[model samples]
Target: MSTTPTSTLRFCLRQWSAWAPGLETREAWSGWDGTLPHGDASPKVDAMPAMLRRRADRLGKMTLETLYAPDIAYHGQPLIHASRHGEATRTVPLLQALARDGAVSPQAFSMAVHNATAGLFTIATRTHAPVTAIAAGPETALAGLLEACSQLADGAASVLLCFSDEPLPALYQPYADTAEAPFALTLDLVAGDDFTLGTGAACTEDATPLSLLHFLLGGETALPLSIRGGWQIVRSAM
Candidate 1:
């Protein structure tokens, strides 16, 4: 039998912020009592300065809002931003510009890239600490969590993990495997005794990030998620 990596995540999930269509995420998340709603999420990032807010697309705005979510001001460095499709909103426009004039605007090109939000977050907060940006198709969240756990194991005090995504650009809409409505969630994790995380090879219907979100926000005792190669990401409260 092929074996997969397994370890106890051993982290205190201090706080989280999530937003989705027609869902007052703050209120619902405060209690973990609401279902994932359907429809376009109302995009609003009140914490960001107006100018910088305007510069970012929907995904960027969500990531920043979740990063700056109330009361997470003291979290340690090394923010992890995970997504299946990164900066897709601006991808089409950039491709169009390339097709038309063989040149793309420096400013648009910068914001449309995958690392744009993480880069902007550092500049906006003036925190030089490291930030990781990851894009791994449907396995994005699983991979991101593994990386974050590894970092914490390496002695980092805490990590801010944000999984955010929006619909693929219209030009590539048919390839989407996630919900039509965009979703963003951030977790402030620090190695502790409050939680235990484990993973193995299995299958499930729920998406990885969503499965984790529901478990944490819902206070479930166990969670199982599907991954490529028949692997499973499992969790339980300690």
Candidate 2:
């Protein structure tokens, strides 16, 4: 086998919030220590008005909840929304409609795209900062982090990155390969003069973005993150 070199991107985690089945509050999550939760997501998106709430499905609501978690100050910063399978829950039904030679609903089709939720977020929050939607198979979270870090290093004060995904529909489960459940993790990141960010090559199988998220929630200042390209990314304490 050919050996591939490792690379890393770094930044400081300013704030974060996550919503999984069993892990709801920061206190409850911190007590669990790296345990992955199962089931549907019921994020606290109550800040959103009732009209806007009806437009978003379970996943979108969870994404917005984490993205706007009280810990995240949401001050018109750039945003990166990453998902392994975006809007698949909504699109699968549309596909079945087309398969049956049935007319597709315009509203459903509009919300079926990958960036649709991001658009809704910008509109709901009334923030004009740049928003990027990303889907990179298994490497989505790392790709989103790199994008945010690049923005920070290039001079932006802060960046917001949110990673969310839902379980694939039963009809599509055979083709879907993802470890994600109905979950959303948001991080408000900043690059500063202090030495708060670093990266390195990784060999461990558990060094993924979601895994690192659990570690970080457990009050870890340093974490090992791995992507699909066989690279490890690490963050060190100040």
Candidate 3:
């Protein structure tokens, strides 16, 4: 009973790379921090504020302060924040502490939530606009994009879709071996555009996580595609 978006949205992609250990830097397609190679080179626990600034730098000429400033010209758009593995690195330590002492640091618990990045973004940008956080396993990226498209269809002027994922702890390394990279994309709907929505069907079978991810990033495909139980597929800009 839902209607599709009549107009398409505009989007841009950003990524962080080389921040995970045991993973080659070439595997990363986004932010490329040199921390992975050095075992003891973890960014300071309180360096998130500065890291956000550095990540925001990829936007070119746009600073975190300017993007999140109160008087900025955001025009009240919606947001979809995505992270397949949200702050896993930060949570591991807290989990270890709780396992040993039956109590955890309140700050660490709060900071490990899936929406932590979104909260920080809101605080830094000083924007009270609607925001949604999604953690859809490997499909986090597509899920976030779909939500952004939904907002645009519902008449939102714009939507900022951000995705980030850090490396897991050594104990959880068996789950995935991908490099640490955070990718973010900001999308805005506009009328009278030359691009057209792609078409495809999503089905759940035995597709690799990276394959699905590549499909989303490749663009220029049809929708209605089947996605696995934990995965999602949606149209993207060309």
Which lDDT values do the candidates have, in the order given? 0.72, 0.73, 0.47
What TM-score goes with each of the models? Answer: 0.86, 0.86, 0.58
Total colliding residue pairs, candidate 3: 20
Decide which is better by lDDT, 1 or 3: 1
> lDDT: which candidate is best?
2
For model 2, how does the per-residue alpha-carbon lDDT over 1-238 read when each residue is reduced to its tens digit? 2222244345777788887788787777567666556876476588886777778888898888887678889878898899888888888889889989778999999888888878888888887879898987766766777788788889988998899888888887888654557788888888853223334444455354567576655554444445344554433434
Structure candidate 2, residue pairs in collision: 202-232
Model 1 — TM-score against the truth? 0.86
3-28, model 1: which lDDT tens digit per residue? 33264556677777777665555776
C-alpha RMSD values across all candidates: 3.1, 3.5, 8.1
Could you give candidate 3's per-residue lDDT for residues 15-59 as a string of tens digits?
211222333233452333323232322222132366553433221
Over all chains combined, what TM-score does candidate 2 have?
0.86
> Candidate 3, after superposition: displacement of residue 228 in Å?
3.2
